[model samples]
Target: MAQLSWAAPSAQALLAASDAVRNPDQSFGLINNLIEYRDGKQIDSSTLAVYARADRKTGQFRNLIRFVAPQRDAGKLLLKNGNDLWFFDPSSKASVRITPQQRLLGQAANGDVMTVNLAGDYDASIGAEEEIQDGERQKRASYRLDLTAKNNEVTYHRIEYWLDRNNSRPIKAKFYSNSDRLLKTAYYRHFQTSLGQERPTETVIIDGLDPKWITVMRLSDWAYREVPESWFQRDYLPRFNPEQAQ
Candidate 1:
């Protein structure tokens, strides 16, 4: 694995620069609502509400949403405390508590799918810089980053990210399998700042495994506030938080 070096402007630098520029206030908390669409039709919709107080803060997230369409009665919940991750699925009434290793694996999987930056978990290298669109307006000084997972067991081999160089925000991401085949791609269409962080408001996930199965996420009416740390505990997952269980 390659370390992000300042001398050559590594991929991490580009990402950090983007984060700093887009989120000048440096607020770390955010809440997002996501909608998943397939074949130009609405198939599923959900909300990925998130909150982050700081870089290493515990109990920094909450994902509350109903996954409807392909699966009628499915809901997924994820809570993170620093390096720990807790995943809960309402349909199965099952919860999986993840260690640091598992957390890395989960982030790796998500990093492959979404253009959203995963802070310092995986090593990334800057590939190229170009100009792209932010909505209909054209922006210059965008960077391309190559992210490779340190763990070999994960499905994705490498990911290419096109980020806005001025702000280091990702506009598009391409994932490839171990055999160098394209796996999936995500496009970020809208962005907003909450808790001083720039997060995508509209996103699309195209699955290579099943091209027909496209997942779209849209964030709206975001609210940021303090949430109980205990909400992230695996043991408490079954209880469900009334505020988060819409």
Candidate 2:
């Protein structure tokens, strides 16, 4: 992966740069507040305490997402480690395998809540250079990154990612399915200092089928913590307690 210092930037390097801007390179935790909307009205909401740490071998993140809000949904966990995704319910003491494409919030998928290094999952190429409107409604010169999934396990089969040309900050992205249909349009906004660099603090997702159906994910309380690799194992779910364990 090439850094911004490269005069002749490679597609892979530029894509990696945008990924770095979105995800921290080390173990981190944050609070995600999700609000679902329907036709401009609030419908449902949830809060998640997310912990992510990079795997030593691949340097990809392994995430532990715990629901911490709305008494009814508390104590539920979603683990995304390597290629496996599992949902564990503390009340039932059951763990079930899940796909990343499963819907979590209104327009947000299970994969959206977890940390993923896109450069590791997709093959990228620069498609075009254009000035696009950002989440804040400001026009920005960006590089259109065309991404194709390296395998079937990824969230989307195709993605048209737009990143700021100057600093590689992700501006927005259009996701497409394998059948070449639009899935969702996501806008990364509200950049704030977290764990060091400025990262998107809010993500606004619009449903491809119904534009009125929206999901807004706001991130906060970001901190670097010592996340153990053992927490990612399937057998550890029943015993894993986010409050006392890690």
User: What TM-score do all the candidates reach, one by one?
Assistant: 0.66, 0.95
Give the Cα lDDT of each candidate.
0.53, 0.91
Index of the highest-lDDT prediction: 2
Query: In model 1, which runs have C-alpha deviations exceeding 4 angstroms?
Result: 1-8, 19-31, 51-76, 81-86, 89-93, 97-117, 132-140, 152-157, 196-199, 209-213, 244-246
Candidate 1 lDDT tens digits, 1-246? 234335556667676665453332222333344445556676545434444333334212222222333344345656554445556778688977643223122112332222223434446877766666554356645667888866663335677878865556668877776788886777776677644566666656676676666666555554444545555556777786545633
**How many angstroms is residue 60 displaced in model 1 relative to the true structure, after the best TM-score fit?**
8.3
Error of 2 at 107 (Å): 0.5
Score residue 17 of candidate 2 by CA lDDT: 95
Q: For residues 1-246, write the lDDT of model 2, one tens digit per residue.
A: 233334546778999999899888889888999999999999999999999999889988899999999889899999999989999999999999999999998888999999999999999988777789999999998888899999999999999998998999999999999898999999999999888899999999999999999999999999888888778999999999767634
